[model samples]
Structures are given as structure tokens and as C-alpha cells.
Target: MNLSDSRRASIAWLFLCFAWGTGFVAAREGVKYAPPFLFAGLRVLGAGLLLLVICLLTKAKLPNRRQLATLLTMGAVIEGFTNICIAFAVFYLTSGMLSLMLATTPFWMVGIESLKPQGDRLSSRHTVGLAIGFTGMVGLLAPKLIGVSYNSHLLMGCLVMQGACVSISFGSLYVRHQRLGVAPFMGAAWQMISAGVIVVLVGTLRGEWVRWHFTPQVAKPFFYLLLIPSMLGYSCYVYCLPRIPLALFSLHRYINTVVTFLLGWLILGEKFGVGECFAVVVIFTGVFLVQNSSFTVSKKEPSS
Candidate 1:
């Protein structure tokens, strides 16, 4: 790529990182004031609608009817579960903690890939990285398992959040493996739309509206989520992927992980104790090893 192309890619990547990192902060704040499902529901729903409008105006290549079911299922699993898990878990877990846990997604992706018949082989470095990361994860979970610092509710949220990560990993792998003949933006539009509708219907069924009362205070975070993370963040990601290399794009998780931790501490005043300090160091070490282990890696996830 030329100098101008490189500059544009860097800017897009930074914006994508900012959008992803701040998204957790926004979600945590929104859930605190609004109904978890509804707040999440509206954010994704609005983003999906906007993307759909863009696709229509641009005359973008869209997925055919036969592909809708698969795309929608992928969306419901990836975005749908991600939104629901974050919404429910924020009541118990801080956004910083959420980001810390989620940094293990690469590990989950590896595990899922291992189960596939035609999965690629991993080097010794990859195994070592996985082991180290698992050690850090066990430390993180020890409090909940031994009932030292967390209660049943907190533990349950952790499990649910992890489950959502697994769901996202599996869905992402399936979509990439199938090589669905759809444009990235078009497929993503349907995925987000389906996910939003499902969450809204579930929220409505649960009478979450009764508990939700929209106010100006909630609007700030909600709008940020709708426009910045859900919409613009994704736009940057898809734009950057074809322009940049996968290795560079992989830096996104690390950057956003730190961003979430720093913002959570600075803005939300979430606690950052010795344990958090240790986890950050240890987990990143493992992730770095895994990422640089010379193993073939997939592209960035379509979901934010």
C-alpha cells in the first residue's frame, strides 16, 4: 500500500479500536440506568437499520433469500448473544472485568478450531500460550469457584458471558468456513437486524419495558453505542480488513482491551487492584505468544 493508503488505514484502525473499547463503557453505563435487554435491543436495532439503509442507497451486493436463514442464525448467535450477555452481566461485573475476560476469545477460537476435522495444526508455542492463558483464566475464576470474592449471581453471570463468547467464536468459524457468498456489509446488516429483533422480542416478552423509562441520562450512552460502536466501529473494521493485513488487524483486541481497562478505571471508577494488574500482564503474555506462534490465524470477527 502507498503512504496515503497506510495513513488512512491507521486512522480507521484507531477509530475502530476506540469504538470497540468505549462500547463496553457505554453498555455498562446504559444497563445501569436502563433495562439491560431494551437498552441493548435498541442500540443494535438502530445500528442495523442504519446499515440497511446504506446498503439500499449504495446498491450493495446483498445475500439472497436462501442465505438469509444462515446469516440470521449467525447474527442471532454472535450479536444477539453478545448483547444479551453484556447487558445481563454488567449488573454484576464491571466493564473492565468484562474486557479482561473477553480477551480470551482467541483461546476459545483455537478450541473450536481444534474440534473441526480439517483444522490446522498448532505449534509448541501455541500450546504453551494456551496453557499460560488458561492458568490466568483459572486465577480469574478461582474467586467465583471457591466462593472467596464472588457470589452465586456473579458466578452465573461469568458463565453466561463465557457462553456468549463461545457462541460467537463458533458462529464466526462456521460463517468463514462456509464461505457464504455475500458481501461483508450486507451479511453483517442482516445479522445485526436479526439479532436486534430477537433481543427486542425477548425483552418485550419479559416485560423489560415496565422497568425501562427512557431519560436524557440514558440517551448519552445509548446513542454512543448505537452510532459509534454498533455502526461506525463495524464500518471501520470492514473497511480496514481488505485494506490492511490480518496480523495488523489482530492488534485491535489488545488495544481495545487496554482501552476498556483504562477507561473503566478513569471514567467508571472501577477497581483495579493487584489481581487485576497480575491478570492483565499474564493474560497478555499468553495472547502475545499465541498470536505470534506462527499458526495460521483467521481474520477479525465481523461482529463487534
Candidate 2:
């Protein structure tokens, strides 16, 4: 692309990253009154319908059976379970700390990918980088995890927070392997709708629906969750995918860290100590290395 185009792409990417970060904060706020699962369900269901309308207006085809299955599976693992875990985590952990735990996803994805025989192999540099970063992440989270004698409620909360981390990691990996023939927005819509159904079912079974209150104070955040971040954010990312470069796209993870930290501090009164700052730097550096590394190597065998 020309210089002008490149500059525009950069700005656009930066904007999307910022939106994601702020959206994370919005989503966290929305869940304060609603159960996490219920909040997630409403967000996805509303987003799905909105996307579906757009698709219809543009004459997009519904997914075939294979694509439907793929979306359903992805929805279950990624959107459905991931949101459930996050809701559980929100009960115990500060959003900032929870976001830090999420920053561990790249490390886990790299480590898991290393086990594949045909794919890229992890290098010593990668290993060292991950270790340094992960050590700092642990340091940042250690205080919260220590001392079992605190409120039993807090202890259970920590466990849920850890579960959220795992859920998000698993979801990312699942998405990396999925194949769908439709437009990215349409594919995403399917996943959101499917996951939303599961969330509603689970939440209702858990009595969230029966106990739900819908005053304007609660409704305001819920509406924003459905319309802005959940629907608009997903659409914005998908729209940019065809226009952005892969290398630059990698920056989303890093930008997400910054955004989440800032929002957590600004909106939630979350604090970061010296150790947390150190950890954030290390984590960001490690992610940069991992994303940029040429982990794949292919050398043709000598002709016989």
C-alpha cells in the first residue's frame, strides 16, 4: 500500500484497539448488576440480531451445515464458556488483575502450539521471554492468591478468576483453528447467537432470570453492553480485518493490555503497584517477541 493508505490503516488499528480496551471496561461495568452469564447472553443475542439484519440487507447467505456446526462449537467454547468464567471471576477479582491474568493467553497459546509436530517450534528466545514475562505476572497476582484465611468468598473468587483466564485462552485457540466460509461478521454473528442461547439456558437454570431486576439504573449499562461494545466492537474488528496487515494486527493484544489497565484504574479504582507495572512491561515485551518471531522453518531436502 501507499504511504497514505498505510498511515490510515495504522490509525484505524489504533482506534479498534482502543475501542476494545474501553469495551472491556464497559462490559465489566454491565455485569455488576446482571449475572455474568445473563449479561453475556443479552450482549450476544442483541448483537447477533443486529448483525443478522445487516447481513439480510446485504444479501448474505446463511451458513451451510458444516459452517453451522463450526459456529456452534466455537460459540460453546469461546463466547459461551469464556463469558461464564469471566462473570465468575468478576465476583472475586478486580478487573485490572483479571485483565492481567488474561494477558497470559499468548504464552499459553505459544506453549500449547509447541507440542504440534508440523507447526512452528518454540525457540529458546521465546521460552526465555515467556518465562520472564510469566514470572512477573505471577508476582503481580501472588499477593491476592496468598493467605487462605481471608474471607471464604474471596478464596472462591480467586478460583473463578483463574478459571476465566483458562476459558479465554481455550477460546482463542479454538478460534485459531476454526474454518468458516461466510463473511467474518456473519460467522461471528452465528457464534454470538449460539453462545447467547447457551448463556440464557444456563443463567435461567441458575435462577438468574427469576431474580433479575430491570430498573433504568441497571438497564442503562445492559443496553450499552448490547449495542456498543458487544455489537459495534465485534463489527468494527471484522470490518478492519480485510483491510489490515497481519503484523500490525498482532498489536491488538498489547493495546488491549494498556486499555484494560487504564479503564480499570479510571472506572473501577483499581491500582497497580510497582510490581504490577514491572509485570505489564515484561508481559508486553514477551507478547511482542512471540508475535514477531519467525517460529516456522522449512528447508527442502537435498535432491536424491
- Each prediction's RMSD over C-alphas, in Å, is 5.3, 3.3
Best by lDDT: 1
Candidate 2 lDDT for residue 148 = 64
Give a tens-digit lDDT track for model 2, residues 231-286. 76676677567678777787786777688888899888877778778877877777
Candidate 2 Cα outliers beyond 4 Å, as residue runs:
1-8, 147-178, 297-304
TM-score of each: 0.92, 0.86
Worst 10 residues of 2 by lDDT: 149-158
Residue pairs with backbone atoms closer than 3 Å in model 1 (clashes): none
> After aligning candidate 2 to the native by TM-score, how far in Å is the CA of 30 from where it should be?
2.3
Per-residue lDDT of candidate 1, residues 157-254 (tens digit): 77778877797788767766697788888888898998998888779988999988889889999898889988889999988998987878888988
